[model samples]
Target: MAHRALVVRGGWDGHRPIEASDLFLPFLERSGYDVRIESSPAVYADAETMAETDLIVQCITMGEITHEEVSGLRDAVAAGTGFTGWHGGIADSFRASADYLQLVGGQFAAHPGRAPEPSGEPRDDANFLDHVIELTDLGRTHPVTQGLDDFAITTEQYWVLHDDLIDVLATTTHPVRPWHPWRRPLTSPAVWTRDWGAGRIVVTTPGHDPEVLDDPNVRTVIERGMLWATRTASAS
Candidate 1:
């Protein structure tokens, strides 16, 4: 059977969720996934309908999934489906849903005023020559970031707070912005993967803009990550 992908997207427009959702179509097609794109969150609510799905690619941010929807998604993944997404799409989704957070293994508490400065001087919301992260001890040997060197991108380097259970892939040291008074720099995980029962989940925090997705290296790694998180047995 051909592998399948269900891309359910919607939420904050600032992320250009639909456009972001569409970015994966060609990649999935090349990887042999029959992809379906949905513009709403109802995909999360339907159980029997989503059961046979081979992978779930979410782009929903800061939205709530109904209990029925959440339950169905969990059951589907536990039965061996894959789940993958990036940034606020997966990591920061459904703030009120603890079960969702526990399953995905992380949450977006704060970008730490990274979004806006106090004086309102628009920092590069897109690619800023900003420092990218160095792969930490746990990240160096991980499949998601193995052989990957420290590279800089002209994008917002994410600062994430992650759970202890996740296998980290890559990370960056974000310096304190003028918006933040504390001025202490912090190391943040930029990518990670975790298992949810029989399911595989891969999450990356680097894709905040289309250009980031356009980067050959970033695109290659993320495309591989999504495929890696799915049921593409023939892919390798």
Candidate 2:
């Protein structure tokens, strides 16, 4: 039977959830996945639906998830359903739910180049910029990142609050920007993987713009990550 996948997308429109998700739909379909796309978080609350799913691809950013919704999704992942997503869609999602944050293993703390003014004023400057991504030894060896070289991409460099239990795949240094308060360069994980119960989770911190998703390297990483995650789910 074909693997079943659920793609939940919505929340902040700045991430271009629909466009980003759409970019990968053809790939998923051609890979023999029975993909279902939903715009509502309520889909997460359906226990029967969750139980039947082999993978969950989420693109909801900075949104709220209910107790029931989180519980159902958590149970599915814990029972060996694969979960994968990129950028704010995964890391910056569900700001109010610690349970959801803990399951994903990271939360967006800040991006170094821009910060709110001390006087609580918003700046008109661009938040996204270019940076180099260096793969770790683990990333070089992992299936998701194997055969890939260090690449530079222009996007939001997400600085995340993450769990140490995760396997770091790739990272980038925070460039010294005038808005940043730190005096030195700080490295942040750009991609990672973790296990929850019998399931697998993969996160990539690029893809802030639709064009970023179109990058061949970025698409390769995501495609391999999804396949790896789906395989894990099937094995479970």
Candidate 3:
């Protein structure tokens, strides 16, 4: 049977939710998934729909989630539905919902750079910088990062408030910027996985732009992670 996947997107447009999600749709379809796309988190409120879903790929940035919606999503995952996403879609979403934040295992606290005078104003530097994603010992052995070497990408380095339960796969160091008063480089998790009941979760914080998703390394990790999550869910 074809695996069932749901792609729910929408929130802060600055993250280019539509374009980023579009890049994954074709790939999911090609991978033998019966993909369903929704623009709202309300879909989580549908118990029957969530039950039928094998995996959920969320692309929503910062957004509010209703209590019922959060409960529905959490219960579904805990019952063995695989959940995976990248960047703000999964990590930075549902800022006000602690339960939702706990479900994902991390919350985006900040990115270590100053925005222009007006927020969302385009800058030549684009609020991003070059950084290397170093694989953890677990990453070397994990299916998602297998055979992958330390790679570099230019994007906003997310400083997340994370739970210790996560099995970190990869990490990056945050350089001390003039605006922040950190005395040393702060190491942050760039990719991670955790178990929710019988389900699986995977998160990577590098796909802020479509171009980042185009990178072979980033794309490969996400694709493998999704497959791993789905397979895990099906086995459960």
lDDT of each: 0.76, 0.87, 0.89
Q: Predictions ranked by lDDT, top down? A: 3, 2, 1
* Tens digits of lDDT, candidate 2, 1-236: 89898999999998899999998899899999999999978988999888888989999889899999999888888888899999999999999999999998988898765555678866654566678989999999999999999998877788888889899999988866676677888889999998988888999988887888888888898888888887362455
For each of the candidates, the C-alpha root-mean-square deviation to the true structure, in angstroms, is 3.2, 2.7, 2.6
TM-score, every prediction? 0.87, 0.92, 0.93
Model 3, span 95-185: residue lDDT tens: 8998998888988877776545466667765568788999999999999999999998888888888989999999989876665678888
Q: Which ten contiguous residues of candidate 3 have the minimum total lDDT?
A: 113-122
CA lDDT for candidate 1: 0.76
- Pull out the clashing pairs in model 3: none
Clashing pairs in model 1, backbone N/Cα/C closer than 3 A: 127-154, 127-155, 128-154, 128-155, 133-172
Model 3 accuracy (lDDT, Cα):
0.89
Better of 1 and 2 by lDDT: 2
Q: Give candidate 3 regions above 4 Å deviation.
A: 114-126, 231-236
Per-residue accuracy of model 1 over 88-148 as CA lDDT, tens digit each: 8888888887788888887776565344556867765423446675776766776766777
